[model samples]
Target: MAEVNYKQDMPPKGGYAPIVFQNIPVKKYFNGYTMFAGFAAITSFSFYMYYQNFKRRRLLKIERQDAINALEPILLAERDRSYLKQLRRNVEEEAELMKNVPGWEVGTYYGEPIYKTVPKEKLLDPILEEYYAHTSEKAYDDKANEFLWR
Candidate 1:
């Protein structure tokens, strides 16, 4: 086989540059600007993909951290207020809310208006007196029984 001289035979103006390959004795990847353009395209594509992936991961991490920060304070408050008094307040408020529900009114067991049923100390001149006038002890019981009968 005759040894071909590539560089001397090919001119830069004709757009053919020879490449010396590692495995093959004499070969060219591509003879012109086509090869350069193809490599540029692949490199740009890889870089764009890597950048977009990084941006997405950064945004997701920021959102997760924000959610954790928001929830942490609320959890800490609840943990700190776990005392019996707070628990009772919560239960009482919930009970009041339940009473406000329309359906709960049907099951109400209160006999009479407590203020009206209980005896009051009426005087000609209303002065705070130290003495105790016995309100009928069974006033509450009487009111409750009357309501039950109804």
Candidate 2:
């Protein structure tokens, strides 16, 4: 690598030489107060950046703590909750509601459910249509008969 000399070799200040406006060296031309202000600015910027990072992490930790607190209720509420007991209660209630329905009893069928009669008209039964509406994906089916009561 070639090194370019940027400094001018000069004689020492052994002889009294008249100092003119442009005759001063680079050091003599520097403003100490301005350099000190620049150092202060750099130091302040570094401190500001460090404080911002610390604040961001602190905020994240607080948000995580809030999330944990919010989820505490659901977690603690299940301490004595029995899923099987609730399921049994729901089944008993459902049985009670269907007990008095004329000619309708708690029954299950194998494979796809088959209706006693085919629907002869559009939107004939709301109950059967509602069941299909909730169960079927209701997308990409070109024929409404896929869910028709038949």
Candidate 3:
């Protein structure tokens, strides 16, 4: 067995420093006023952004309304023309269908007026489906079967 020589380590002059058990207090970098100012700045910026978004939405809505207003007259004219054409067609259909009847008028049951009380009789226009109801059995069946499940 070989012999080994070792030097023992020793603590410097005064023994080890005392162990600290209590927590050390740290100084705050920002005071209450500074923190409050930062929060206010962030909040104000967010509100400004929200206001900008609101303005953009309002502008877009106004533009859409203007576009709709500009197109209204043309659309109304087209609708009127379509309605008059349908009315003419309805009158012709009634005349053809009632040709065999003795005294059946186009808008009335007989030669008498359809509306008696009113000074100016306003005839109710039937919808396209109702106007063609008597033309085909299929149309009648479709109307009858409509909402059957309900």
Candidate 4:
């Protein structure tokens, strides 16, 4: 509880410390033009970003509308065709169930085993193997199998 000497730590001649930039005294004053320029820049940037976002959304909406308009008819036609195909399939399935075809038992089994199964030695021929591989991977053949009897 002795008296605290606060005067000794302070500069001998001090009211407030002067701000110096590279040894030059900086005047403490607000530059209205600089503040205004900064505010304008920030506001303008925000507005520009908002405008770009709006423009992008509008363009995407237009593109989506265009795609829907263009593909709507084709999609409708495909839907109708698929429905007809399904109906035909249901009818055929019902008939097959009633008649109970000898070789058409319902099971997880795929198409019949290859009767003319190629020998392992035959697969060693590069030309024959390549041809068989190409035929096995044929897109049209795969798709055709979906609608045709094996």
Candidate 5:
């Protein structure tokens, strides 16, 4: 009887080499103008947005003031003296409160006031008061009706 030996599992027959791996470092390339162009674009966009905001806010403020001016005479005539007086006080208080706020000058590049340097004491100025006082009954009626519809 012959005994079969399976000790080394057929052993190594040839010179077998292992696979070698090489790592190559890749260098990143960028254009010189790319960074500057990006910065310029961001700065320009930011400036444009700020300018637009200033213009819009200034326009809104003017529109609001104009509307209030237009309605002043009618409201004063229709409402009682006490109520008008109270309303004037409230408006002045609000203006004072908003005076110190940032962007108070809104669109002014030099931070100057829209109108005069000094603020008006009352919402209804002497001009409007005089206009209402001197207006005839027919003209007053016509103006009041026009304002009401507007």
Candidate 6:
């Protein structure tokens, strides 16, 4: 083996350049004005959408209310007709039930008035059992059985 001489490498005069240990800050893509503008645009768009939804809901509610108002008189008239029909049926039933009894008026007991506070006394709705008292037992049972099956 031949003898060889090698020179050792030395650092620069300022010692060595400082190592980049910390992260370097990058340039901002959006400035303050741009950020504010984006926020304002998004906020305005959201507000506009909210306002449109609210207006649509309000219009729908008004339309529903108008429909209900328009049908109110017809519904009331139907309810009144049904009430009168039921009243008449109740009167007929009372008359039929009291036909055999002596001194038993439909609205009075032993010729005495049942109600004196009002000029015309309102008949009470009959109970379910009492209303169907005269009906055949088989018919009532059949109706109940049919309802249960359905």
Q: Per-residue CA lDDT of candidate 5, range 14-124, in tens? A: 755766778776875656698789899999999999999999999999999999999999888876675466455645655675687876643232467445654645343
The parts of candidate 4 lying over 4 Å away from their true place are 1-33, 100-150
Two-way lDDT contest, 3 vs 4, winner: 3
**Pairs that clash in candidate 2:** none
**For candidate 2, lDDT tens digit of each residue in 33-119?**
988999999999999999999999999999999999999999777743643344345446656767766655432223222454654
* TM, every model: 0.32, 0.28, 0.53, 0.43, 0.32, 0.54
Better of 5 and 6 by lDDT: 6
Clashes (N, CA, C under 3 Å) per candidate: 0, 0, 0, 0, 0, 0
Question: RMSD of each candidate?
Answer: 25.4, 18.9, 11.0, 18.0, 22.8, 13.4
**Residue 54, model 6: Cα distance from true site in angstroms:** 2.3
Give per-residue CA lDDT, model 4, range 122-150, as digits (tens).
42223333223323456445655656765
Candidate numbers sorted by lDDT from highest down: 3, 6, 5, 4, 2, 1
Cα lDDT of model 2 overall? 0.61
Per-residue lDDT of 23-52 in model 1, one digit per residue for the tens?
756676786798889999999999999999
Clashing pairs in 6: none
Error of 5 at 79 (Å): 2.5
The candidate that achieves the highest lDDT relative to the unseen native structure: 3
- lDDT of every model, 2 decimals: 0.59, 0.61, 0.81, 0.62, 0.66, 0.80
In angstroms, the error of model 4 at 111 is: 33
| Residue pairs of candidate 5 with colliding backbone atoms | none
Give candidate 4's error at residue 67 in angstroms. Answer: 1.0
Report the Cα lDDT for candidate 5.
Answer: 0.66
The better-scoring model by lDDT among 3 and 6 is 3
